[model samples]
Target: MDMFRRTFAEVNLDHVAHNFEVLKAAFPNTSFLCPMVKANAYGHGDVAIALCLQQAGARHLGVCLIEEALLLRRGGVTANILVFRGFDREGAEQLLANNLTPVVSTWDQLEALEEMAKTPVKIHLKFNTGMNRLGFSIEEAEKLFDKCWRHPKIQVEGVLTHLFNGEDADELDGDSADQLGKLLRILLVFKPLNPLNHSLNSAGILNALIVREQKNPQHILNQVQWGLRPGLMVYGFNPLKRQDILPLKPVMTLKSVASTYRMLKVGEVVSYGGTWKAKRDSVVAIVPIGYADGYHRILSNKAEVLFNGYKVPVVGTICMDFLMVDVTDAIHGCDLNDLRDKEIILFGKSDQGQFISAEELAHRAQTITWEILTSVGERVPRVYVGDWAKRLGVAN
Candidate 1:
């Protein structure tokens, strides 16, 4: 079935590939570029996005769970895939059967592997530097290193940790730098193991590298083979908030159209709870999308859309599958005689060359970049476009 509809997401793989190339070039010493395709590649459709990154020269792909890995495998993605969330005994057996790497984070996972390992399993050890959510502590990791030191079935192929605030601006010995320093101290213990050294995510890649430079100005980032896993940036949002950092392009374009228009008299209420009333004789366009599509309800009166380059305010509480945009100021530029189907720019580049950015929408929603991207509801049909293969110099 064709999923394209009046409201949909356009995922430009060309933009994705470009971002991947830029990120890979930044870390030449990187053994491989592992673009995290978890959370459905941040709601851009994981299998399609992952395939694009692979063709764009990703050395490996990262996912959150075994189910995600299996989806890619079944979708014909044969690249080296790693499941970041460690699995149970059955999940570990499936991981082995599927030949996907598991991120062994906890002692329970290690014991599960021990009980289930019929063959040698190459695992990446996860250390909880400060996130304190997943993975073993530093002392527990020391014991884990010894446990896997020469295990018959467990092969510690790499070590990694998450940088909680790697994108924050404060540079001097802050949480991000301090946490990375702690991880490095532990990573040093496994230097002799020669695993694929990797710890930087999208936010961490540029900022953490800066931290490394500041902390060790004399020498390059150690002898271990470092790699990077660009997640959000891979989908084309700069966590550092500097567009020049990699000149990333916008990948996902959430869109819909003004299905119909209505005239609201002064004092007329709109949507639920009477939260909004037209103070003036206003023209409102029914935008056929709402919180159900991951457009936060908090963005009810706070958000705006693009119409003929004019900012049209969303004036009412967003409904489950519809909302209203006040286009009184912009209606003159559109076909006023036939106001319906005037074209609504939910978020992305507009015909007028202006962009209704996700960051702006996110700000209105009281959230961040990741939430905005990942929360783009699954019902919004994802249409992957662009010539990534040609751009990557690969045969189509």
Candidate 2:
């Protein structure tokens, strides 16, 4: 497939590999470093990102669906792929065929797995420790395991939970601690089984590290094989938006070119709704990207794009396929004719070493960095670059 549009997302694979190592160092006790590659690697091209991580020594990977695991398997991801979403009978059959692990949290899922397993199959038991979204309750898990009714073919490989308030350090000592305490009690039931235990996400990992430094480190983590599954941080964006956190690089740079240039007179209206009127003679650059491109419509007149290392306001209402930027001040950096072909950065690093972070862009759009990255529509081609690109046999 050929990408004809100038508007696209550039993914730096090296940054991803670097981030993987940094995250591993942060969670030193991680027996399994499972980076979530679901939602098409958060819309950053799953296959490429997965392969890069696998090469960077990721022995395990996490996804949200059976189909997502199958995609990675097809893409030559030989690592242990754990499907976070529990499976049914039909989904269980595929798991057996593909050698994929399912995170079981429901009786139906257990029944389905037991009925389908002719050979031994490994599964992770998910406990609901206040994150009511998924997983069985502590009492439910205790009763289920105590019954000793698990299929001989069904093997419990790990016990895991989600941290609902992992971003706040105080919550790590309170709510997250309560959650882990529940997970710890569950761990006792499976102690003889020796299953890996994990509960920290991106924010949880950072907050947990902070708690470890401020107090004695080896309480819940000392006795068991622990795992860390970081999603957003794997892509090099800070989930907590703290400057003191890991020094990770932004992997994807959303960019476009100034496709058309126009000189707007004072009082002249621009774009739909005419919400913005030129206060002075302004150099308007029509960037070929809009709401359909994952650039939020609400960012109509609030977002800024980088032009020649200068931040230019996105003036007027953003259209379905275009947005107008006032490049009058930016014109001082380059000639008007030169500006037409100049690369405009929506977010991430530019050729001139200037960088615009997705964190800032998401903030301006009244959203989060996760949404901003995944919201990038499939229409935008993902151009893979970095030292690992050629190693992955990928090209821009």
Candidate 3:
């Protein structure tokens, strides 16, 4: 089946629906659910994931760039797509034309958006809420607010900010508090305009207690703004390390099959760099996926894949098209002969109770959940399963 040339990420629409329900259950009062589908829906295939989310009651969609949003529109998704990373003049005009909302980060970009549109453009004014990566500064935010108030063609639909230190609940740094406070201050400046003021991301929503402790608990959530922009949480990964938290099913399961399996003699080296050698006679299975396909080289010798409900240790350096795993002492019920061309669970569950989780791989890679999901390369085909996939008639 040309396994080496083809790797597929099995996306469970049922999991997506479950994740959406979890988010809804957590915050039933939330007005809009902005499921971030940026980075090709975290490499789960943006169009397919968006459809699944939309079918699961997602009213708003979030993307990293203008092109991503345009891709969704081209794919027949007609939801309110929000470009999280604000765009430039041409991009802004394109967004306006397609009825997509651009999160304006600067006064010039906002002005540029204002100039291109014949009709009013809905926008979310992003403030520098400590991430300091995007968004307008406090002074710039005030100026943009004033300008939007004056401009008849620019409608400030929302005001938002991102939290940088959401992972550490106990250490809710002064910077995040200041950023939230700054956003609140900015919101007051434009209160007469009644723009949707929101300052929370996945971490903010998950760590509401931290946010509440710092600022006015009532206003930070229910009372004050329009809604929260939750991305990772909606996708079913816990951003915060809280105790006894609600379980969230991971929406994407990246998997490939074992194309070749062989036994290697002791002292024999495997893969590139000769970093790993067999201590004894070992049965090695080659999985048809690698770094180029987003299996990640960093996971070399540190990751595990599931086969026949058993966890197999990944050995040697991960290659561009394959990686070797030690399957000599696989758990009971594992049949090496039957596993050839059979599905190898790289990061998802199997019928026999084997599953590789994105969170576990992310920890091994020393990165975030977002990076792990987004890094799944384009070559890996996506198989969507569940009601959304059935309704859309998208092939597995």
Candidate 4:
């Protein structure tokens, strides 16, 4: 870790706690939260984030694959883990061994598990309400219910579906609502089992996690279970791309130090491809971070870094290990003397009042905040902050 130099990701776990509270507070107490910790908690480090969220009252955690679940279990996470990507036979056996829930999305998956099981296993049934990405068709769920109605080793404990377009639609108008309707019908069929149900993702939670089912008002299944599984929102991002009413705190701040400075004359180019030419004499700072570190090449000359509370624009094509930022205007009094090792804020708050959020970097990279966060590479060692760091014996 000592060889890491100054470039690394600084994670503020307090923000995660704050974001969790904000998301959970939005819904009723009857609701449950399983903040998605897949993709390394969207690149914020899954094990750490998962543990913090669990401590904050998350009953279960959602991951996309079996490896992710295994990683969590290995990390000593004892809470219920839900694997969204329904597994194959081998994967199902492993999931069962780990006590993780595999969402049965396909009928083949159901039959395979039923055939392979030696003993009973709890499962969550997933229906392809509309996403069509995964899950069983409603007909499949109904038929499966009949088959599993009394089958051993295949207890359907929960029902779930994904909302493909939760961001654009309101409560009762769009595809999300329709998907909810489809899921509701299937749930009604499974009402006798009284399985826990879920359908909301981050966007759905923001707009509508719990909506009253208009028809069949008397049935218990008429209500949508607030099993809102928020992913990006837990990391303080508004997936809808509007004003973040939740105002979630950004948990990770990508940063590095200015290792060296460059003096370029007028008309001189910088970095590879000679993409940026100096209009006048310019001073540049070479930061030890680049596309290889998850700072996309698309940010070549468009990205900005914070220098002592000022914005320094990046110059030329970003290399595998480094990128140069024009510090000409920023190289006032003190920095002119020596630019070596001066703190450069890539995207996050600095001790000197300079601040940049993931949203800014995502914009320049022409990607979403989720990608910006999750794409941070492995080499950039993460420095844990907030109370989590203290409890984990890692805070600096």
Identify the candidate with maximal TM-score: 2
lDDT of 1 by residue, 152-179 (tens): 9999998888878877523656676566
Tens-digit lDDT string for candidate 3 (366-387): 9877888888887787887777
Question: How well is each residue in 135-170 modelled by candidate 4, as lDDT tens digits?
Answer: 788877768889778776789888888888888435
**What are the TM-scores, per candidate, against the unseen true structure?**
0.92, 0.95, 0.91, 0.93
lDDT of 2 by residue, 1-396 (tens): 586669999999999999998887876666767899999999899999999999999988999999999999999999999999888789999998999988998989988888888888888989999989999889886676764336578788888998888776335357777788788898888777777888878887776665566665454433344568899988887777465778888899999988889899999989998999999988899999999999999998898899877889999999989998999988775667766668889999888888889989889999989999999998999999888998899866
lDDT of each structure? 0.80, 0.85, 0.77, 0.81
Model 2 lDDT at residue 388: 95
Residue 168 displacement (Å), model 4 = 2.2
Backbone clash count, each prediction separately: 0, 0, 1, 0
- After superposing candidate 1 on the true structure, give the runs of residues whose Cα lies further than 4 Å from its correct spot: 1-5, 168-172, 208-226, 241-243, 337-339, 389-396
Candidate with best lDDT: 2
Q: Any idea what lDDT model 2 has?
A: 0.85
lDDT of 4: 0.81
> Which is the better candidate, 2 or 3, if ranked by TM-score?
2
Pull out the clashing pairs in model 4: none
For model 4, what is the error of residue 48's alpha carbon versus the real structure, in angstroms, after optimal superposition? 0.8
Order the numbered candidates by lDDT, best leading.
Answer: 2, 4, 1, 3
Clashing pairs in 2: none
